[model samples]
Target: MTDAGVIDDYVTGLRRVLRGPRGPKIDLVAEARDSLLDAAEALEHGGLDRAGAERAAVEGFGSIGEVAPDYQETLSVPAGRRPAALLFVSVPLTTLLWSLIWRVFPTGPAAHAAWPGWFVPVARGLDILQMLVGVIGGVALLVLGRGLRRIRRPGTG
Candidate 1:
């Protein structure tokens, strides 16, 4: 059976208010729609017309203000995870790739000739700094990854 305007309006409001990872947001709204449709179908089978069943379904589902926050909160989890996961995988890969590139292909005169006095030490220092930063970043990622599990929800003491 076709949905009534009330169901459409409710779903639209739900979609409008939610914010987070797109995939999970879509899945949550789709699930909510399916549930409401199911409820409306049952109500229709019990003899209510389409409009009446849909109105009842929307009322039973709850208001957008009440429901949307929970959905947005759920979305925040995967949103938070993605950047952490990216950093965990990326930092090492970046360090290794840069090292390989430096070894395989040298740029200009720098590769063939020894650097003059101050330049040599400065270059070596920069290389050391790069490596040090990568190591520190990796350690930080590990600590943060573990700490992410202990994070409090949106609002609480």
Candidate 2:
């Protein structure tokens, strides 16, 4: 293949592996193209012809499968944050839902006493479940968000 064809294929393979906004992807492609051309120019200076220089550049850079994962890791958001953000959003929403349910059903002492036996048990069960969810979600949000923050902090991994 021609020099341009080889570079195009490399960029195309990279684009296939990367997952993000178009702006980042385009930037990555441009950077990769520039790097490949630079490497090719270096090889040409070392006495290889244009086609040989391009081929050597691509080979030295490694195949798309080999290099794309490193780029993907750098470009993509860390997976842990997704669950943390979800928990942050969900905890309050769940609490609000339970609050709305209680408001609609009136789950106070008098209401509980007047309600059917099955109703009290079911309501109590739901309350327990809601509390558990809220506690677990809150803890997860704290832990995950804290961990992410630490990872992002300056001079730290």
Candidate 3:
């Protein structure tokens, strides 16, 4: 059987103060619980009763106030990276790919003379749409990052 209250209380309090993405928070909380339980078991093996060992284990864990900033820093890293994927890498790389393709086989006077009537307008429309979507998506991500920052607890990001 598990030693209940002391460990439960410590984990609950730790969960309360931590602010981050859901997946990381769950992993960190579960990790903390496992470590506490293992330490408690080791203490009990040294002749302390389960309750006494659990209480002591909790005490050994620093106060939530003292540890939360560290946890917040861990959470912030992934939060910061989410935008860089699209904004820094995918967007620029995709734009460069398209530019190179057009440069190698550009639609100039000779190419346009051979092209069907429908191709020009269709290609032009798609170009406009691509630019519009890129601008809209970039703005949305920036706004979303700002919104996430606003909602997060101070110093949590």
Candidate 4:
């Protein structure tokens, strides 16, 4: 195959392996294309025929399978301490706010007497829903924190 054909095949395989935005993928492909062409031109200048130069360029660059994973890792978001810290602070604050609300508006005769008959049930239901949402958020925060820790660990991906 021609140099262009080889580059196209390699880039197609690369695009399939890479994840995320189109812009980054296109940029990476363009970079690879430039490098491959440069390598091929260098080899040709060194007295190799066109076909031989192209082949040598592709071989030296390595196959898509061998290089894609490394590129993907580079593209991945790095785990940071900030997100875990934010979650840790927000989760407890949320729980505290909900607890205060629950305490301030005790579900008792005084509450029912002060508000309409429907108000108590509605308020209780809303409180329960908010609690459930808070719990889910806490769990999500925990999971995110754990994942961040794993990503931050040495010699891990």
Number of clashes recorded per candidate: 0, 0, 0, 0
Look at candidate 4 and tell me the lDDT of residue 84: 50
Residue 33 accuracy (lDDT) in model 1: 91
TM-score of 3: 0.59
Model 3 lDDT-worst window of ten: 148-157
Would you estimate the TM-scores of all the predictions? 0.61, 0.53, 0.59, 0.53
Per-residue alpha-carbon lDDT of candidate 3 for residues 1-157, written as tens digits (9 for 90 to 100) = 7756899898888888876688888888898899989989999999999999999888887767666767766677666566556556756766776686566557878976776676667567657766865886776576456654555553344
* Number of the top TM-score candidate: 1
lDDT of each: 0.73, 0.70, 0.74, 0.67
TM-score of 1: 0.61
Model with the higher lDDT, candidate 1 or 4:
1
1-157 in candidate 1: lDDT tens per residue? Answer: 5745788788887887776788998999899999999999999999999899999999998878777767766776777677667666766766786676566656687654753456556557657766766786666565446754454532232
Which of the predicted structures, 1 or 2, would earn the higher TM-score when compared with the native?
A: 1
Residues 101-128, model 2: lDDT tens digits: 6776786667767666676676677678
CA lDDT, candidate 4, residue 48: 92
- For model 1 the local lDDT of residue 16 reads 78
Ranking by TM-score: 1, 3, 4, 2
lDDT, residue 5, candidate 1 = 79
Deviation in angstroms for 9 in model 4? Answer: 1.5
